[model samples]
Target: MRFNIRITVSLKEGMLDPEARAIQGALKNLGFETTALSTSRLFHISLEALDREQAETLGLQMCERLLANPIIHRYSVEVLQ
Candidate 1:
């Protein structure tokens, strides 16, 4: 079976996101009011798997192995068939 997965990786709470902050600052300068902002990376992957559970597990393994840094990053995985 083939499965499609979406993985989102982001900095953990209390971690500073320079890009988000810079963008927010720019927005403020442009008269856009923003109280908070953050950034994340989204990855779309398609692979072969036996089931949804297996696909989700593979997605998480990808995150743990290379996509996200355990100490500073967190990730979410969704299996889209």
Candidate 2:
């Protein structure tokens, strides 16, 4: 079966996001009011697996092994049909 997956990776709370900060600063300079900003990496991947369970398992493993840093980054995995 083929599956579509969305993996989102972002810094955990209390972790500084330099890119977000810079973007917020730029927005403010452009006369946009923003109280807070956060950024994340979103990956849309397509792959084939035997079943949904296996697909989910592989997705988790991928996140743990390479998609995210457990120490400072939080990630979410979604399997899209």
Candidate 3:
């Protein structure tokens, strides 16, 4: 059997504001400078023990149900076949 597993990563946009600020402060402390900085969440997913086509469908369903909020932000999936 073949498998095409996709991993989707997402984050709350405004939720990262505070983290971004913290990163900026850390940078300042380290004497590293940047005009812009941002933060995001991460997710690692996999679909195994399935064939290529089924794995694709599973990845899509996972994205629609859990990986993406559908209200804010966008998501991308990467499949390893």
Candidate 4:
């Protein structure tokens, strides 16, 4: 069996602001400060797995363990066979 999987991840709302401020502060400490700001990003993945169930399980794992933070973010997946 062949399975298709897609994963999408992104930063949570307030997460980005604090991260950006932290980066800006660190840059200032390094004497390399800039007015430029930081924003969030998205992670996208597409892969094929040998078994439908396995693929789905692995995809879910990826989301649960690595992709989504769970602290302030949510994720979804699509499995096709």
Off by over 4 Å in 1: none
Winner by TM-score between candidate 3 and candidate 1: 1
State in Å the error of residue 42, model 2.
Answer: 0.6
Best by lDDT: 1
Q: What is the lDDT of residue 42 in candidate 3?
A: 52
- Per-residue error for 50 in candidate 2, Å, reads 1.4
Rank by lDDT, descending? 1, 2, 4, 3
Q: TM-score, each model?
A: 0.94, 0.93, 0.60, 0.46
Give candidate 4 misplaced runs (Cα > 4 Å).
10-50
Better of 3 and 4 by TM-score: 3
Candidate 3 to truth, TM: 0.60
- Residue 12 lDDT in model 3? 50
Full-model lDDT for every candidate: 0.96, 0.90, 0.66, 0.70
lDDT of 2 by residue, 1-81 (tens): 999888899999999888899999999999999998999999898999888777788888898999899999998888897
Model 1, range 15-78, lDDT digits (tens) per residue? 9889999999999999999999899999999999999999999999999999999899999999
Total colliding residue pairs, candidate 2: 0
Model 1, position 74, has a per-residue lDDT of: 90
